[model samples]
Target: MAALILFSVTVSVISEKGEPAADLLRENVEALADNEYGHNIYCLGYGSLDCPLNDRKVKVITGEY
Candidate 1:
């Protein structure tokens, strides 16, 4: 018999340049669309977040408001 185990995690980051980290991250995922879980990061600047989350999705909270 054989089995496979897979897991995923979310990380928080901040970028002070033209491109936000989340956007870049999404783009990077695009490269691996074939095997990507299609994670989404919603950056809500200082607001109550009620994002739909699952094992493959995470809410990105920010304090820029």
Candidate 2:
């Protein structure tokens, strides 16, 4: 069986409250995944480390927003 390797890139953003916003971060992540490059990138919010808004397969890492 061939293993499929996906490349995920995390983009961090700080909110007004100084907390990671999962929703907003997911939006940016989704946009990257939708890009034409097809690099399989995922957006990780530095604030919302506890709960990620994006898909589990996308590999969302949150920290230090």
The numbered model that scores best in lDDT is: 2
Candidate 1 residue lDDT tens string, 1-65: 01111111222323333434566555555554543233543454333454333333324643322
Query: Model 2, range 1-65, lDDT digits (tens) per residue?
Result: 01111112222234544666567556755665563333444455444343333434333643333
TM-score, per-candidate, Cα-based: 0.22, 0.23
Error of 2 at 57 (Å): 35
The per-model lDDT (C-alpha) reads 0.38, 0.42
C-alpha RMSD values across all candidates? 16.7, 18.6
- Return the lDDT, model 2, position 30: 62
Cα error, residue 43 of model 1, in Å, equals 44
**How many clashes would you count in candidate 2?**
2
Q: In model 1, which regions exceed 4 Å deviation?
A: 1-8, 11-21, 34-65
